[model samples]
Target: MTTHLPDAAPTNWVDRHAPSALRPWLKLGRFDRPTGIWLLMLPGWQGIALAAAMESRWPDPLLMAAFFVGAALMRAAGCAYNDIVDRDFDAKVARTAARPIPAGQISVRQAWVFVVACAMISLAILLTMGPVAIGLGVASLALVAAYPFMKRITWWPQAWLGLTFNWGALLGYAAVTGRVDWPAILLYAAGVFWTLGYDTIYAVQDLEDDALAGVKSSALRLGDAAPKAVLGFYVTAFVLALAAAWVGGLGPLFLPPAALFGVHLSRQAARLDVRDGVAALALFKSNSLAGLLLVIAMTAGMWDGPASAL
Candidate 1:
């Protein structure tokens, strides 16, 4: 009997529609929870949008599509790698005990092969980008390799994840312009705080399990102050994003959508309930919309001539 992951919806396509023989493989790659792909992909999209807007055009469709596919593959690979490293701890956690590795649906060797396959395909897509992007893509491997160990060493593993996941901001910008810029750096910083906020919310679901298993996370660190901490993280992210816009000379027309983006983040922070795992998961998933809102704001910023909002 295959076990549906606790965090995955019961009706997830992997469980409901994927061929039974392939379910374990798909689940190992986390195809059952696509929100992660969006979360990972959006930063790259935002970076592409910012670069294109600065060039006075919309984001390139080809680049956007490539990032989308790359994000999916890389996220899958990262998930499998995390599973391989965390298998023992996962078995000890209620929510994670059913994962492919821990549940014995997939062997560790097979999982490693899956990781390599996904990564090689992602590298093929990366190669289509410019040299700078290709270099950044290779550099990101160091971060990915280091991430699984972060929880064991720091209470702020989410901060590390922020750095790792948001590197796409730099990679995407370089992919378009063949170089990095201040706007890309600022956008990358914004993405970091954004991840810090959302991933902390995600960590809330594992508070008890993590504690019992002796791992550290921001949610465990913040305790009842999680909401306020998230609020701070989101606010910083919002301001940094706008700063990137201003620095990029995105026009005044960017304000409306940017304001909406900030408001959406604020609402998520306000509704956070660390004690309620279900609500926390919902709040975590909602970041996908928040990310899209920023993507729109950047595009709207380009709609007008490049000038700081006044």
Candidate 2:
């Protein structure tokens, strides 16, 4: 049987059935824990929905499929790159010591190869999008490259991750609308704050290990106030999401799901417990549902449209 990482679900498919030789590679990409992929991809979907609503049309299934593939590839690449940069720190942390890199399952050079392969595939998808979306995809490279170092130099690496992961919102909107409008920007901002909240909760899982490894995080920086900080971040995220809907001229039908989204976030904050890592992880993973709700809110906004397109 495959040895599961501390963070991976025991029954995850990668551990249950993946070929032994490929298991290390899949783990390197965090395929054993698919929550990150959903978190990374949903912002793009929300943007697609918003852009479609703006045009009073349904989101393009072809474009959505492309983004789904691209997001998975890019997230895998990003995770491999992060592992390459963070091998040493990861070795020092109990939660990360068994990762493919730190545990000797994959060589740094091999991981680099994986990163390149995934990034090249993602680039191929980007090339099929509009010029503005392609440019935004290229620009996101800087954020991805800069991310692993943020934990070393900043107390809030989650903020940088927010910027990096949610960039898909802008790119997706540009792909459909061929322009970066106020709605996309606002939606991107909301995604950033949403990430800030959930990732802060995730960081709680590493508070002790991170502090011991000398890695700074919003959770460690806030100390006992981590939950409160998460609450603040979620509040900002909820407000910005609504603002994006309003500015995008969404109708009243969007409010109910949006309210549910807000309630979901509120409950996460209310139940947050900095001392409980398992609960923190559960809370972090719940953001996927929250992201889907926001996507629904955006889709619901298109109740009235001049015309419709698939």
Candidate 3:
């Protein structure tokens, strides 16, 4: 007997007011899932923490707040753009069939207007940054606009996502120091690997749907050995993040958080059941914890000051 689980009830006020057609668009961009925003925000925090280590102060709360808001707006914009581009493809995939445009809830023109409004809000936030940081923020638009197409042409679209999502690390450093540094680059690279790792796990949920629809992904590319690939990516992310902290001149307190993050990644990899979509999603969401742990570690390391302060 097939047991039918009820459609998930929408809980938020925005979700309720969302045009029935726009609902899928919002869901497609993961407005329902805040984890993507958290992932995007963490790299900005890392940059802030690294900058604080350089200045011998806690990271600026105002700057962090700006990043938080900017990330939310920009991530939403990116999602709308992606859905507009991928609407047909999304409709063919079971996992994405109900997306706003794919489900006939929102028109392409409407999605475009939504995207533009979100971009305007993001740009306003960007203006609050220094000229160099603002330029970096604006430059990121090129990457964002092109990302929805990368999956059509390349199996490594996740790499493109890494480049786009982690741009905040560079912007964070620039916002504080008004310049980029090796530590920020390393942190950004680490975030890229981190994104690749988690997003690949997320892709596992759509593997069959993707295969049927001719969609390419790291999960499909790695095939049965996806778990191993995830492990390698997570390991690289951890190593690069440690390099970023060291280059930033953080103190010993950073080690505990770093160690804890490593443990957490390993645990996720161990518990991951690639064949189960539910399990895959659960593991994927757990990455927010991984990102948070690193932020805490980096924050603590910056707070204590470098050895010179002692």
Model 1 segments more than 4 A misplaced? 1-5
Worst 10 residues of 1 by lDDT: 1-10
* Cα-based lDDT for every prediction: 0.92, 0.90, 0.82
Model 2 alpha-carbon miss at residue 202, Å: 0.1
Any idea what lDDT model 2 has? Answer: 0.90
Q: What are the per-residue Cα lDDT tens digits for candidate 1 across 1-310?
A: 1122285888999989999999999999899999999999999999998888888888999899999999999999999999999999999988889999999999999999999999999999999988999999999999999999999999999999999999988999999999999999999999999999999999989888888899999999999999999999999999999899999999877889889999999999999887788888888999899999888888878876656443
Which candidate number has the best TM-score? 1
Stretches of candidate 2 above 4 Å error? 1-5, 304-310
Q: How well does candidate 1 score on lDDT at residue 300?
A: 79
CA lDDT for candidate 3: 0.82
Model 2 lDDT, residue 225, Cα: 90
- Across 1-310, the per-residue lDDT of candidate 2 in tens digits comes to 1112285877999989999999999999999988999999999999999999887888898998898889899999999999999999999887788899999999999999999999999999999999999999999999999999999999999999999999999999999989999989999999999998999989888888887789999988998897788889999999888888888888777788989999999999999887888888888999899999999988888885422211
* All-Cα superposition RMSD per candidate: 2.6, 3.7, 3.1
Tens digit of lDDT per residue, candidate 3, span 1-310?
Answer: 1111112224743477877655665674577778889988888988888788767678899989989988988888889888888888988876677767877777899888888998899899889889999999989989998999988898978888989999999999999999999989999999999889888888888887777888888888988788888889899999998888877888888889889999999887777666876777778888889988887887788656564432
Shift in Å, residue 97, candidate 1:
0.4
* Ordered list by lDDT, greatest first: 1, 2, 3
Candidate 2's TM-score: 0.96
